[model samples]
Target: MSRTSHITRTTGETGVDVQVGLDGSERTVEVATGVGFFDHMLHQLGKHGGFDLRINVKGDLHIDSHHTMEDTAIALGQAFAEALGDRRGVVRFADASVPLDEVLARSVVDLSGRPYMVHDEPVELAPMIGTDYPTSMTRHILESFAYHARICLHVSVLRAANPGQKPDAHHVVEAQFKSLARALKYATRIEGEDIPSTKGVL
Candidate 1:
């Protein structure tokens, strides 16, 4: 089966476009969101998810990165949901745990056609990764994506820093995205011939 979707979302605050192939061999991906750190995280998602994903977004950056980040996630989430369609023959539920230096993150996902999310980040971040990407926007972005995609998602930072180690926002956040990517890859995989839920629809 072919699973792919292209979506465009234009609003007064932002304009976003996304293309996704859930089961592509090449995994060709391109993303340009004008936010450096956000772009890096999206790259991690695409690279680790083992899918073909593309995203382009333009927003009122003069105000802040909030609009751009949220809108990008919204469009990307819509693309994924569209690609999955009826959620046929997919794993539908998966989890992943990943560690990066001083940070460890775990993600669990269920594609139940319901939107719900729980995010827990115990580590204290530096507030901003750089001049553009705000660490506070991390939860907002993930929440927006899960809400739009109609998925049940739970993310937690199991580890952050030690006595001597310092909290690095990049590592902390990147670990979350990477773990989420793996979970999504597994959950979106075609593993069976029928829908995963008893309700007969997802």
Candidate 2:
């Protein structure tokens, strides 16, 4: 059985197209969102998670990166849910800790049908990553993903900055994305024939 999904989402703010393959190591990843650093982060998912991912988004960059990130998460999350189908025979729960220079981030996920998220990065950041990518919208993007994907997600920054030094916004956010990709890879892997939940459904 192949696990794959494709989605195209359009709103007044943005148009997003996403393709995903859960077990497609041989597949390629292509991402374009116009936000340079965000594109770099999404590439981390494709490269680190060892999955096929393609995302193309056209959003109102003149306003901000919000709409692009928002709709991309929406389309990607919906594609993930579609690919998983019944969510049976999967790991269902997984956690990953990743370190990037000055940042250490952790991501825990449960493939439950219910959607919830706990994001615990409480440090002050430098406002914007680039021209359009806002530093504050990181949580919003992940929140949208968890809701649309219908998964329980918890992400935190365990250690960042050094003594009195300020944290690097780029490293902080990149670590989270990398950890999230790794956790999702583990959680979505096929493991058995039955659902992992006690309720017999996920």
Candidate 3:
């Protein structure tokens, strides 16, 4: 099975095209979503997930980050769905435990056609340190991605993990990507496994 996919989408809000190869050794990330921080996060996602990604996007950022972020999720999710056609013979469930100094965050995923997200952490993030607005943007991005991609996601941060230590926002956000990468790695694995569904098709 070749883990390569190419997808293009042009919506009223955004236009995007992306190519991803899951089994590739060399990764190249090209993203132009008018959001530098978001682009960096996506690049981290690609690099850590062991996938090659190439992306081009044009969106109406003059209004807000909504269109760019949402459309990016939609495009990327569609690509992932197209790539994993039928979802056969693959590990369909995965979880990861990631820590960023004081923040011990975790994520779990189920590649099911049910879209859901459980953000079990407080929405308090330091200002001007990272993506400007981590709580809203990251949550929105992950939720939109899950819904569009038809996957289940759960993200949680351990309370009192490390108080009084203001961890870098970049590190905090990067931990999330690393967790995503680890979960995706397990979820996309071919384990000689069944379809992991009772409908006989997925």
Candidate 4:
């Protein structure tokens, strides 16, 4: 069976469309969220996770990027959950550590059918990575995604080496996204013919 899902979500704040294929190797990605940096991050997520993903969002950008970012995350999470189906024969837990220059990020994921998040950034970042991507919203995005996807996720910045200063926001955030992608990719892999849980369900 093909592990694929398409989702369209519309609210007073935004309209989002997302499509995802879990067992994909094409690394195909098309994302336009009205925020350049966010689009870049989503591309990284799909590429590194070995998933084909497409996202198109129209949001109330006249105010800020909050609605666009959060709504996109939610829709993407919904797509993932739908695609996963019964979560059978899957490696349900995984962790990854990724580094980019001076930033080292670690992410752990559990497809537990419950929403939970624990996020920590040891290094301070600039207020913004680009013209519109706020550093603060990074955690919120992860939280929103985990919540809607019903996954337990933990992400932490383990090390930031700049000899005495904070790492660049872009590098830090990129490393986190890459780590998350890798972790999720491993967790979602089809490993066996049964659900990977003691309770016989996820």
Q: Lowest summed lDDT over 10 consecutive residues: which window, candidate 2?
A: 122-131
- Which candidate tops lDDT? 4
lDDT of 2 by residue, 1-202 (tens): 7889999998999999999998976668899999999899889988888789999999998988888998998888899999999998999999999999978999999999799999988558888887877888899989999998999999999988888999899889999999999999999999889989889998
Candidate 4 lDDT for residue 82: 95
Error of 1 at 174 (Å): 0.3
What's the residue-level lDDT of 65 in candidate 4?
98
lDDT of each: 0.92, 0.91, 0.76, 0.93
Instruction: Give the TM-score comparing model 4 with the true structure, all chains together.
Output: 0.97
Q: lDDT of candidate 1?
A: 0.92
lDDT by residue (tens digit), candidate 3, 1-202: 7877888889888888888777655667677777888888888778777778888898887777778878788878877777777788879899988876666677899988778888765545655334434446677788877787688899776532466755565666667867887788788777875788997766
Candidates in order: C-alpha RMSD to true structure: 1.0, 0.9, 2.3, 1.0
lDDT digits (tens) for residues 54-95 of candidate 1:
889989999999999999999988998999999989999999
Q: What is the per-residue lDDT of model 4 for residues 1-202, given as tens digits with 9 covering 90 to 100?
A: 8999999999999999999999885668999999999999999999999999989999999999999999999999999999999899989999999999888999999999999999999536889977899999999999999999899999999886678886788888999999999999999999988988889988
Error of 3 at 142 (Å): 0.4
Write the number of the candidate with greater TM-score, choosing between 2 and 3. 2
Cα shift from native, residue 160, model 1 (Å):
0.4
